[model samples]
Target: MGIIQSLKRFFSKQTETSEKNHDQALQSHYYKMTKDKTFRELENFFSEKEGFEIRSVSEEHGEMIVKRTKGKPAFIVVTIIMVRPFRTSVDFSVASETMLFTDFGSSRRLIYGLYEELNQRLTFVGTGLGDELAK
Candidate 1:
């Protein structure tokens, strides 16, 4: 990582996973699982982790809002969308609640960590598929 990139990351309070993210770790990840199953797994995973609390869930929209109340507080939004049968994409938006200018990449780290966990539990698929799988 270049110094400019590092500085930008350090000063940024939020990070979101997307299909074309320059940072590979921040790219949207695809999994071979049903949306419902993925949602359940995510809820259970967060519930099992200490200091993390699920604030709300919208099954209709396939979205979950989570809050980290313990050390280094953060707000997280998890989105799961099914592009095809048994092909789902998971994206994360995380924002660190720090009192200073930046969170020092805490949000990025949190998203990366969450993706790592999901990758371990779910069937792996390629990242940043976008519409390539549709056509």
Candidate 2:
């Protein structure tokens, strides 16, 4: 029983670490049919979110940087890639406000929240979601 419990703990921590370090763009349904539309929708979501301060938006590059003002403050990079003329891919990356490894899970949860709102705001193109985002 002790061994089993230890294994469970180890697996749980490993899962958390894996989730804490992965790219979520490849399998999220947040992809839109158009870059402009996708950007506009994300703009609205990020702008209105409490504690979210959008720093920059590069339409040409289809990317935006948002600073979270809540806790220790972190920078969120939102990137949109146009797969095709009508197929857009949106991805997010969160950086520490300081060069510290303190992003144990808050940043991730924030991303999850963003995706949830995005999924709701944008027309659900498909029901699939990245593992982390699915939670």
Candidate 3:
């Protein structure tokens, strides 16, 4: 009985360690994705293209907030959020002051393409996220 209990405890410890490692990997991946210079440039490019000035960008939290002035009495604020998990895939969302947009395929593709372009310009150090946006 004691031997069986010891085995159970060992397995439980191993499972916990595995989970922790997976979490760390996810965090590292997220950090790499956010810290990529290409990604940063793309974010700025998008903000400018949309005529919104970026207010702040939180790479650790994977959030970007931008503000735009749309004439008198109308103001638009946009937020870009990313969710990445090691065990799963990366996800992205875009929201405006008034509405939540769920269509990500096109947006993701655009981002990925921009990253690719930057990578080419920079000699392709790799984004560590190949084809992730395509999926």
Estimate the TM-score of every prediction. 0.92, 0.68, 0.30
14-112: candidate 1 lDDT, tens digit per residue: 999999888988988999999999999999999999999999999999999999998799999999999999999999999889889988778888888
Candidate 2 lDDT score at position 122: 73
Between which residue pairs do clashes occur in model 3? none
Best by lDDT: 1
Best by TM-score: 1
Off by over 4 Å in 1: 1-6
The digit string of per-residue lDDT tens for model 3 on 9-98 reads 333311111111222321112222333453465475656554546666666654555444442111222222333322221222322232
**Candidate 3: TM-score?**
0.30
Ranking by TM-score: 1, 2, 3
Report the lDDT of model 2 for residue 127: 30
Instruction: For model 1, give the 10-residue run with minimal summed lDDT.
Output: 126-135
